[model samples]
Target: MLARNLPASQTTEKVVENCPIVMGFDLKYARAGFTVMQSVLETTPDAQFCAFNVLHDGLPDFAQRLGHLLFDGPRSSITFIDVRPHFDHLELFETRHLSRAMYYRLLIPILFRNAQAVIYLDSDMVCRRNIFAMVDALPPGACLGAVRDNISRGDRARGAMMRDVMDHGPEDMLELSLADYKRDVVGLDNPDRYFNSGMVFFRPSEITDSDVQACFDLCHAPRYCPDQDILNTIFGDRTHLLPERWNYVLTFPETVGLIPDDWMRHHREEEEHAAILHWPGPRKPWRDPSVPQAEVFLEMGRRLDERLQEVAPEFFKDVLPAS
Candidate 1:
């Protein structure tokens, strides 16, 4: 039986009093972070929320305003960590849409030393269920728990793309051939079962400064997805594969056709019960209102707006229309 289908009575009822959820964001992704945090707070209601801002230029002001809008009566508190100093030595990879802050996710263990375990989420994702349920399901001895990157599993071309990035040295990324990537990068016998780094239940004790440093070092290499590549390289086999419902990645019909049959069947079944809805790729629900899952995000945004209007109408007055 899938974890998502487990009745509420059977689900673990442990109240996660201090479960810390760390999210990375910048000015560009501030709104997405708010939606993510809002969704989590709505679902968990009692967990601690922390935001790590990679851009320090106006973080203090943003954090103050965000706190006033989100944290009303102390049901949950948001902690803001300025990660500018950490980014000084690290490389920031930026494409047209993706930001450098995505790489900062790997630094969660180092940033929050006191936390035994931390939940790291990309700002583009929204929690649809109580995340503590996933946290409680972490298997023993596993350093990290995450869902398989079904986008890669469903399509051979996508798998090859991942291999191209992983196998080639930073300087040789463009020279990739499918045969060489299969034979040299990821072994032929090993199917590409890379997990998405967007939503992770991580045990901080399993990570070390050296591990963090190694990932950062890999960032300088010629890689397509920096943090994701490092995570797949380091914790690929060590990670415990969680159910797809825990991190249901949104996809369109065209992409869905590319996914393998078995994975597709599983995706269809688990999607309805998804605990977190992850908007990967360029089409974010917040940005493009036409997206299939746009309503989910928009509804959450509306709910947040109403809450803000009730609690702090002055702050709500400055709210910009969702892009």
Candidate 2:
């Protein structure tokens, strides 16, 4: 199935033979993506890793080199596909937190048509466990699997008139009443149906090229959280909500009072112990080291710098230091 919105021009350097575990990001987050790759190499060393990178200011030199590092017989291979031309033409919504790269996961079906499934991840996440095990448990006929954005889910069920609101979520939005917005803009009554797009198990066979087109078409409208809105609108109903540990957004205690106690009760696992520690929001560990989970990313980045130094000295010398 040739996805109409999928990128046709790609520079490939040995893509994986089977369904790949993919991550997409622009050049600005190349370091962040590398940090994620480092964590995966440390924990899930055997996983098939591919990066659908949007290039700017030339190729991501260090990121590409780390992809070729052969540990235990392709224990970790990083394949990169250039995804610039596909999205460059569109004036998609974007902000300090959301990049155009966030929308690239929609291309999974077109990229790997024959594969049963593919894993997609945001660049800023820290992987502590082999999440492939979770995919094995995905129910037959499920189109996609992801953790519910607890903060997003709870707000819909929230009784209080005033509550901490998430952008483009179940609240008064774009001058529409809370009821009308959720029903109209989001096209959902039950917030439980919404899932964070940070990490996803995308089943290519369950969807079609039009689903991919729908996602791209949504990009025309500007919103606070563009890619997320597109995803929830297109794929929410058929989604299988996974265990929270897979995405563990890591916002509970870090930014105090951001997450309500009741929400915490629903998701009991602590952030540090979770499978994938994802630090959303603008203050990333690299930019602002004071964030709660910053150390997890910083320490690994320090080590990643060392690993790169060992592999290719001239390019990565004294880079990737802890913030």
What lDDT does each candidate get?
A: 0.67, 0.64
- Please write out the lDDT profile of model 1 over residues 1-323, one tens digit for every residue: 22322122223345664457777766556667777777877776343343322323246574456555575445565666667787777666555545567677777778766676778888778777777778777878887899887665544544455444343344444455533443355333344557788898888877878877777777665555567767877777778889898888875556556777777788888977888888888789877878667777777777777776776677653653344
Task: Please write out the lDDT profile of model 2 over residues 1-323, one tens digit for every residue.
Answer: 11112112122323344556787765557667777877766654333453333223235665455545522234555667776667778777664556566667777777777786787878778777665556665898888889877645444444322223334433445455433445577687675566788888888889888988888888877554567767788888878888777888755443333446665664664443477778776667788878766777777778777777777678663343333
- RMSD after Cα superposition, model 1: 4.4
The TM-score measured for candidate 2 stands at: 0.78
TM-score of each: 0.83, 0.78
Q: What TM-score would candidate 1 get against the native?
A: 0.83
Model 1 lDDT at residue 285:
85
